[model samples]
Target: MENQFSLAHLTVIDSPPPEMTYLAARAGYDFVSFRPIYMGLPGESNYNLAQNKQMFKDTKSAMKETGMKLLDIELAKIYDGVDPKSYEPAFEVAAELGARHVLSSIWTDDRNYGIERFAEICELAKPFGLTVDLEFVPIASVVDLAGAMDVLRTAKQENSGLMIDVHHFHRSGDKAEDLLNVPRDWFNYLHLCDAPVEIPSSKEEMTRILREERSYLGEGGIDVAGVVDRIPNVPYSIELPNIKKTQELGYEEFARRCLQTAKDYLNRQVKT
Candidate 1:
């Protein structure tokens, strides 16, 4: 099967949607993921493509010019009291753009409430032909593959699934063998990045590593190849967010290097 690689918006968070699409295409990525909903965190950049008519049109034009597909749009955080219905506009834009997935996470401590809300969001997203992918991060309520599976099992929504980010999988103490227990169909796509083998000393450091210090595939100690080998065939979203590298090389060159390195790493994995 041909590998489908996507330029995750987080990889170039500072770039607008139009530039992201153009750069992804120029860098030889097969698809691009967008972040239409802000993560609601301080210092985070977001774009409201659904409401920005001109930006939306420009992004569409860039995709047309580059022949790049829309892989997904993020992010929907299922926190307590945050209405999933409020995300309808973002879903509308994703559907109009033919995106395949929505990256989401739960922030509440109550597992039951989180599951219910996630299910509701899945139902809401069904009509838009979008899969709601619940990403498991160490800082979030659903912190591991098993926790994410618990929600997926209870929600029982066909349109809901798990989205594994390699950094989170490693930091959460999840093993490559653990992936064997998951149903293959439960995975829609995955986020790929690399990090140092040493675990962070504190939550603050971990957060910094995840958001700003990740390395390209094969550049750090993460067993990206091992994890990739275990997962079923699915598109990969290159999500390395190295602020320093981006500063030195610029977004365009940084993106190109990311794609090339990922392709090279995967090719070596196949050969081995």
Candidate 2:
């Protein structure tokens, strides 16, 4: 089987690295998603692409130390209501790092033109041979599997499709069979996380800890194994937003735990 493990940048939000690369590598993650200017960084939450020309290079170096690869660079503002043009730098960085994909979200309300506009951006990436996958987030547009598929169909591009996030499955009230029905080819990545259905808080409450209060594999209420079963074999990543524990346990331990949890889940899945 293809070993597809992804390390999400969200877990290292407070690490003291001038960049996010080292934390990923130290935790034994294969690939990770990075943000040129992450979402909730000080004042520039929206359209937070900084002028740090070396951010990409620094991040690349971080990967070198840890033997980790960059899977995608994030587009955080796209979810917070920033113009799509702001995402160009992230795409540029992903290309520069020799990454294969770029991930972002399109709010449900933006369906008017979000997907179409995304298709237009695909042209820019083809030159670099990168495929873009829009993450189906519950709080963002494309809340459910069907809605996300609509965007993919509208784009009609081989490179664009849905990135099934486990949390969103519960948020959108979708089941495992609903996920299995997805055209297998349309899936590019799997974002793994499990949380309770307690109306998961929004960024309005606290930016960093959204997925943190979650439990490990089979510990939470989410049907994570069932969700994983539906995706076939694809690149898997974790966004364990541990609210309080990360402050105590630190990023490296957090990354290790997340990876171990994922391994446990995948092993059980293989047995199943």
Candidate 3:
């Protein structure tokens, strides 16, 4: 089950239902990521935490019917200056939902404090036996691969490491040499998404590009297959934010297409 592929919360964050498990299952996904219904990123629309308990309740119920477990709890929407004590509730949520990992990226002004913060978080998550997956996003303050590794190393937490998303992987300026640099065991989870050749100028533009122009792995400009071939095997999840495309097609169709393409690509790599 560690090799399981899953759907990211962003795919269906807007209209999460108790039946979301069914959608992921029918789409052939192995798990569903938690975006936490009410939490939003800075300057974005915010959903009050009042709805989190209900959404958590709904997600738990849905998993019972569909058998699609919650893969991870996303901390993407919660950025810097979060109350250190406030995360207690999130860990509690992850534990309740059978989530193994809590994922998030932090900003850089407090880079010196990241290791300490990570150590504290790891200790908190450790009591629940839940680990943390850190992703480096350009928009985030700690925006580089080196910065991420440094944080992990300084924190010295075995329970916390990186989750590589292809979009972030390439954009972070990781070279093939970068692939060789990553500690195999450190990449605990991964995401596969694609964008066309155009380089996005800003975070908002990047989101728009991914949402509008990205295609399934083999169809896009990203050397995803190459990257996958090089990295040590880990759980890879499809995280296309093609909301614009979904307006024309349904989730299941797009998911099936993406998964099949990914599976086919990986299968071929295996054969070779």
Candidate 4:
């Protein structure tokens, strides 16, 4: 089977979308995830391909030249006061770029409201052939796999599912066996990265750890092998972002190392 390993935009957020695509392709990634919407606060690197015609053209050209596909576009936060319909323009851009999924998360405590907004977003995305993958992170309102399932079930959207980011899965105190309870079809794709066995003392520390200090496959304390074994036949987004390492080695070298390390880890898992 072909391994669909995608390079997440967060791994190289410093590069523009077009440059990121080219770097990911050159580094042997099959697909690249783009962050058209910035999930963080203001002053973050948010690319508006819908408005920037030239950047959009360059991104499309890069993908065509490198034969790399657009795996997903991200950061669709479902929160109170945010109009889900406003994201239709972003969805349109994702559809035009041939992205198969849109990554999103819940930011509000109101489960009923969260479900309604998520469903609305799914409804908006469905016509474009995009699946809404709800990624549960520690800092988000839906903070675990179970919470993500709760939202997905309540939303009842045909084109919606859970996105298992392995780091968040482990850090959130979830077990590998928990995957057994999740419907196989509920999983659309996954993000892979390793982290220390020791949990961070606080949410801020954990957020900082995940955003800037994640380790490559097999280089940290996470049970990467066990997690890989549990989830079968799904595309993986290598979301490890180590700012220090990237600064030392540069994006190209860092991207190459991440791909090779992950490939080695997965290959060993298959043989075992």
Candidate 5:
């Protein structure tokens, strides 16, 4: 089967949705991921398509022109005091863009609260035919496969699934072999990227690396092939965010290389 690749918003986050969509299509990707739901992080631009009508229209125009589909929308964070209903507008926009998955993560250590909030998100997304994929980030509360799996199992939301980002998977110390314990149905897609073999020693350093310096596939120490080999066939969202490289090469050129390197790595994996 041919692998479908997505130009994740983070890969060329500097580009707005319309521009990113065109770039992804021109770079030869089957799909594209967008961050229409604003995370309100420092240095991050708010594309919030739910509220930005002009940007949303332009983005839709690009998608229609390029025939590129929206793979997923991020991120519905399950943190303390978050109202799951707040994501409804984003969910409505996702369905309008034809996206089927909504990415989320556990931000607070309160497991029970996280589970309840995540379940609420799943329910809210259900009307729009979107699945809430719980991604375990090394910097977040659900920092490993076990933590993410436990939430989904306990929540028992049919519209919920687990999202594995290879960089986070390795950083969190979960082995590729550990994927064996997760049910096949829980996997719908993967966030693909590689990082240096040397793990960061502090949360701040780790956060910086994840947001600014992720290595290209096969150029880093991650066993990307090993992890992908264990999961079901699904779209690979290349979320490689290298600030310096993007600055030097520009978003279009960087996005093209990201997709090319991913294909090269996957092809090599097939031959091996």
Candidate 6:
């Protein structure tokens, strides 16, 4: 089967889920990864679809009309003193929308605590048929491939796996060789994007670039082909978030370019 592409919400962060669904369809995406679970980050909107009944209905309507599937829902973070049960509502909403995965990350530096919380998250998402994918963020406590693998191993949950975001992997100084031995089942999907080869010196600089200005595939410094070749051939969720380009090109156009660049880049890989 051909690889499916998902229009990740971060690519069009300003658009609500309902509108994002339609936009994804128009932009030729097979699915969408939404941020229904609010994280309250700066410039981030709270899209609490769990409580917003009308918005939920609208989102469902859009999904039905566009035939767009909910690939996943994000930010089910494993943090200090966090209650995994608290995300039950978002899990319910994601299940209702037919999402197959739940995105999570480790925030606390305590390894045992991270494992416990991540396992709890997996258990909570189990009944909903959601697989929790642990992403390693550079600024977060789980800062590399080893840390992410450790959490999954200790969590020991069937419903848990790892999510490799190319940007984060590169930022963490992890190489494509590092992924070769990882179990294929651990990779449910990938966060596809590119960034400048130069590593930022400060965590704050990295955060700024990650949230506001990721490059399109092949346009930046990442050895995307090498990285992609190591992982499972699963859906690629386009998570390119460029604030300036979005402002200049508008959401629809920016989204189209995101998809196009991705397709072109992947095609080149095939030809080579």
Q: Count the backbone clashes (under 3 Å) in each candidate.
A: 0, 4, 1, 0, 0, 0
lDDT (tens digit, per residue) of candidate 1 on 1-272: 88899999889998999999988888889999999986667877668887788999999899888888999999888998989998989999989888999999999999889999999999999999999999999988899988998999999999988899999999999999889889898888999989998889799999999999999888889888778888888999999999999999999999999989988888987534
lDDT of 2 by residue, 129-244 (tens): 77877777665667778887887887888777578778777767788888767788877788887776555456443223254465566666778877777777888878777767
Residue 176 of model 6 has an lDDT of 91
Q: What CA root-mean-square deviation does each model show from the true structure?
A: 1.2, 3.2, 2.8, 1.3, 1.0, 1.1
Please identify model 3 stretches exceeding 4 Å from their true place.
1-3, 41-52, 76-80, 211-213, 269-272
lDDT of 3 by residue, 1-272 (tens): 23468787666544464545678889888887766534545533332233466766766788887888877776733345655456767777667778788786776477766657767777878887788877887767777678888888888888887877777767777764576787888876788877765567788987666545566766777767667766777667788767666777777677777778878767765324
Ten-residue stretch with the least lDDT total in model 6: 263-272
Assess the local accuracy of residue 222 in candidate 3 as a C-alpha lDDT between 0 and 100: 75
Ranking by lDDT: 5, 6, 1, 4, 3, 2
Over the stretch 56-89, how does candidate 4's per-residue lDDT look in tens digits? 9999999989988998998789888989887888
Better of 5 and 6 by lDDT: 5
- Model 5: which residue pairs collide? none
Clashing pairs in 1: none
In terms of lDDT, model 3 sits at 0.70
Candidate 6's residue-wise lDDT over 35-108, tens digit each? 98888887788898998989999999999999999999998988889988889999999999999999999999
lDDT score, candidate 1, position 19 = 90
Off by over 4 Å in 1: 270-272
Residue-level lDDT for 185 in candidate 4? 86
Better of 2 and 4 by lDDT: 4
- Tell me how far the alpha carbon of residue 92 in candidate 6 is from the true structure, in angstroms, after superposition: 0.7
Best by lDDT: 5
Kindly report which residue pairs in candidate 3 clash with one another.
Answer: 108-141
Q: How accurate is candidate 1 locally (lDDT)?
A: 0.90
For residues 1-272, write the lDDT of model 5, one tens digit per residue.
78999999999988999999999999999999999889899889999999999999999999999999999999999899999999999999999999989999999989999999999999999999999999999999999999998999999999999999999999999999899889999998999999998889999999999999999899999999999989889899999999999999999999999999999989987433
